[model samples]
Target: MAFFDDLSHIGFSTKDFYKSTELYEKLGFELIDQEDNLGSKVNFYQINDLILEVYEDKTNSENGAINHFAIATDEIDKTFAHVKKLGFELIDDKIMHLPFFEHGISYFNFYGPNHETIEVCQKNKE
Candidate 1:
């Protein structure tokens, strides 16, 4: 079966985490999940079924407005292998488990030729 399921969320890079998050809140979006890894912070907000993922960035050299877009998959290992076979180098190739979640979320982000990042993830589901 094809590993990919659906589009999970789209990520944006922001220098000011609280400022941007507040802006989203004013737009009727509410914080659903957030995680701080290393020095980087990732946040997920949702309005109805739409999800927007944002991350803190100290240095964003790219002019692109998008940081990365996530694709959901049921079989993350197979999906990761497929992306590897396509010759895309993965920046995140390990399991990332959050304290609030049960299963570990496995994912990888690869830079396209244009330097835009794309992520395929298998979310922790019961």
Candidate 2:
């Protein structure tokens, strides 16, 4: 009955991208992917099966916290509809796409009970 496969990643906002990457690397996280999209640079790191996302946020003045978390879903459209039917406040008007990995990723965001951002994404593949 679960719509998501697993917790795909957790994101952190950083004012200094390079400095944050270096710090995460020292903490045993290996950089897996990087991209320049969404008006800023994003880097994905992995330590075992965990994917941690760090993205540039120059306007962020305070020390960062978990910006958002993503849940992996194979059936994006179906899940999106289900979430909508459940009446959760959706952040994205429609599913959004980004060139993230081998192919790309399509996702949408909705606010949780506490107004926390929760992203449901499907990583497109061949």
Instruction: Kindly report which residue stretches of model 2 are placed more than 4 angstroms away from their true locations once superposed.
Output: 1-65
lDDT of 2 by residue, 1-126 (tens): 989896687777777787767655754568999999778999999866778878887887654555456767789999899888867779998999999999999999986433447688899985
Quantify all predictions' global Cα lDDT against the true fold. 0.68, 0.77
Q: Could you estimate the TM-score for every candidate?
A: 0.47, 0.49
Candidate 1, lDDT over the whole model: 0.68
lDDT top scorer? 2
Clashes in model 2: which pairs? none
Backbone clash total for model 2 is 0
lDDT tens digits by residue: candidate 1, 1-126: 999885677777776677667655754568999999687998998865669877888687673357666656788777677767766656766645444447667677775433557676677686
How high is the lDDT of residue 118 in model 1? 64
